[model samples]
Target: MRETREKVQLQPLDHDLAFLDITTEWDLSSSYHDWRPSIAVPATFVPATIPRVIAICNQKGGAGKTTTALELALALIARGLRVRIVDVDDQEASISVWLRYYMDDRPEELRYNLRDLYFNAKVKLSEASYPTDFENLTFIPSFPDLGEVDEKNPVGADTCLQRRLRQGADDVDVTIIDCGPRLGQLTVSALVAADDVIIPVKASSILDMKGVAALQKVVNVVKDTLNPDLRIAAAVLTDFSRSKMTRRIGGSLARAYPDAVILPARTNVKVGEAQLAQQPLRQFAPRETTTLDYDLGARVLFGLGAAA
Candidate 1:
């Protein structure tokens, strides 16, 4: 990815430069004065730690969980890090569907996937890790039938990810799990396996803010009995319009999770087009503000140097 980026003569999009200079006034003008599209960064993130597993989850549908997973994976890949994206969302909208062009080209035979990990103990994580169109970016596809785990929920469903995901993560620099919208055992399994949890909330919905409290309870429970290291590491404000509501939510989250990184991915119309085109937003609309937001997100979360 670094080589590919170097060859392309990367520079900040004109819109991104505009972001560097912005004025604002809002309902919470005094309290939210510190809000910015991108968060501050240091010279580097944590040690180039290998296998820093993260889970992108939100109970609300259309909260940008999958978008957060895919775009952040692409952004990390741009920095030359090996990343694996796991589709734990056993719904129609998993990455398997969005990036079908990249996911559908496997050899003609029975293939292993996330379903096998839940039901078939014989299936190793390596068997399910498949390649995508991008180098150094692996994918673990899931099917709708995998939802049976939620319906039937076999014994020990909660720890399947904790028991399996890390073994496969040994070779990669990061593992990102795209969780289903339901905050059931499946999503709990994701939380159990992660070092960090990124909650992507759509900025337009006040209901989105209400869901955060419910999610916070779940995170506390997961920390107590499951993964003690698990934390709400970041909050992503998706489809940010810089409205008064956006600032309100931003301030609320900052107060709620003082240590977590808060990133605002500005709205872009091309996201759906890229999904329809069967490509990542980073590749389909490299110059869009949303793409750079994801890039800034990946760098900020992983402790990479700030890019111009």
Candidate 2:
């Protein structure tokens, strides 16, 4: 069978300039100043020695999980870590689309959908992964047929992703899973497979907060039963506004998950604009405030200096 292709214009980036100016051009004011200092990294902090599996998950649609996953993946790549993105979201497949936009020259033979991993975990993962234009980054594209896996409810369906990664992705420094916006078998598999989960919440809406609460319950259940090592790393606030209600919810979230990190709302419109352009925010608009927010997030997640 032939694969569907969508052509998009690719943007050229000055790699030398981007790498040199990223840290100097970063503006810290865009982050919530009140809470930024609290998570600041110490001079003696050290990143984890082994690879980590992170899942950017939220059961609510439009909660910025995909955006967070992409930005965080870029940040890790910038730090010289090998990262792989697994698109488990059968519906949107935004990450796969982003890769396709960047690499229009991708060969038909290299195009393999993540759905293949369900039937043949190890072999499909090794065969499906394609390299992006960016060094140290690779991803497995998603296909609509991935939705079919949910219906099968095959034995060990919940652990297929984890098993595949363990077998085929041992050399990867970090693997970020972009889960679909529902608590289905796929999402459950991601949660069970992940070492840590980052839940992106939209602070302006109370409904999103409810979604977070429900997801937290599922995280608790998974940790207790399926994966004892699983942890809720943080709850990131996306498209955050400084409205009164936003502040109220932010305060409530901080109080509720006092131990877990609650990242400041990253409000820059450039985030969405960059996504539409099929580019990472840092690569497309390095000096943007939202890019800095993502950098901070990546640092905090990896035990690197938050203020770096």
Candidate 3:
């Protein structure tokens, strides 16, 4: 038995299989800096089974919509799925800044801005795609000029994004769009193209609840008029704290939208830290509670597990 145990311990550990097993105790002895696990693509992995387009949207700013979009994309990539992020938010171009920050620190020629595609009508979607350091992950960087798309083509601006993704990004397993905090042409374009929408709400604010109601009204209107296939997949709470007020607000939100899935609040400082470092949570602090929250949230979003 001792010899058999020694032989088993001598076997090489598979580096590609890095999924969270809630039942197993994590080994903390290993260096956290060296903990990034490669995704092991299964032979049976199918692209058709997953939702093709997901828009992380909220009409209200500071509601963690951008963070949710970024983390969810990372989690999906970690699951051995190919993902492309479309940064449609032109105000801050937060995702674009993150991508630039990442590329500036590294030495790679795979970088292209979204403006190249948005400004030129003849540019193919695949032509604008840029590779990231993460395997199976790519993004179309946004620019401030993206906000002017509405002015440039007022008649068909609402469908510009939809047409672009359909023409160029058909090969990706999933495309996640980070929308600006408003229900304008850009947001409408995203909703029209999305197969599912994930709304991130801050749990402690009553105004956020009102924002959700307003956003839902727009979503319903879009569904009835433009996109019959779009649906509100989930509303996740961000920057949540375990307080009486938060619990009260969360309960109210649950009761208000019974059909919608309300996810647990993801309260962690590492989320901000990762963003500051221009790295995904999985790459910056994989074992942190925030990373785990993103993993659980992704599972729920993709129907991999029960809603948390």
Candidate 4:
């Protein structure tokens, strides 16, 4: 058998394959600089049998929602599943901008986007779902103007995304929606659209943990009034390295969402370079330890491997 590298064993909330720990050590043995071991993934596990609509959500900005969404989607695609990713956040920093390889810099130059699907009924979901460089992965870009939906609060605004995605993304095995920070119509729309919500929090910030309260409040309201089946599926602690604070956050997430998976996405500074290049970390920096974290996260969530 191969020698083991893990310093500590992490127990998942359940028997499912999920990465609950976020800490890793730097490789002292290597000539190169690398985060040594990825959080353990199980040797075997049953993956999801049906398609999933997962929303990457967090009310706190810079908490890693976009990173989780795009990286997880890429990981799923790498597993040979057809994936459709929707960038619902309209900010310049969102996936809508980072994922502009197939899209024009000028939002108006694009044929279709969130502005078309959400603001105007004439545009169909398929029209906005664009093909990406990857074979099995598709992209749906959102522009700055689309943020108006939060302000306009159009008729059936909350349910509109669910309806569109259900109708448009039916061909894909997984659909990941990257949500903007803040509780409002846009976030509500994503929650309403998703069957599962994956919340990303900064491991170092207790303030980010506090933001979950507001998100959970909104989620409770969504469950009561709209999508009763909606669930908080996972809490991903990003920028994670082992520390007293990270362990505390992980434990707190575990206690709060007893039935949900808690994962740590170990930090990689190369993430920004990947984003600037407008490529998923899987493609840009496949060897990066943090990319491995997202890959293992995808497998764990989908049951692609056994729990470690």
Number of backbone-clashing residue pairs for each candidate, in the order shown:
1, 0, 0, 8
Clashing pairs in 3: none
Clashing pairs in 1: 45-303
RMSD of each: 4.9, 6.2, 11.6, 10.1
lDDT of 1 by residue, 187-232 (tens): 8898999998889999888888877888888889999998887877
Models sorted by TM-score, best on top: 1, 4, 2, 3
Over 87-159, each residue of candidate 2 has an lDDT whose tens digit, in order, gives: 9887654677787543344576555567777775445676777777677788877877888878787778888
* Residues 116-163, model 4: lDDT tens digits: 777778888887877666667788888788878988888888899888
**lDDT of each structure?**
0.76, 0.71, 0.67, 0.75
Arranged by lDDT, best first: 1, 4, 2, 3
Extract clashing residue pairs from model 4.
Answer: 42-306, 42-307, 42-308, 44-306, 45-305, 45-306, 47-302, 47-303
Off by over 4 Å in 1: 1-49, 100-109
Q: Which has the better lDDT: candidate 1, or candidate 2?
A: 1
- Cα RMSD (Å) between model 4 and the true structure? 10.1
Measured by TM-score, the strongest candidate is: 1
lDDT of candidate 4 vs native?
Answer: 0.75
Instruction: Name the best candidate (by lDDT).
Output: 1
Off by over 4 Å in 2: 1-49, 101-110, 306-308
In candidate 3, which residue ranges exceed 4 Å CA deviation? Answer: 1-51, 101-112, 115-119, 306-308
Q: Model 1: C-alpha RMSD to truth?
A: 4.9
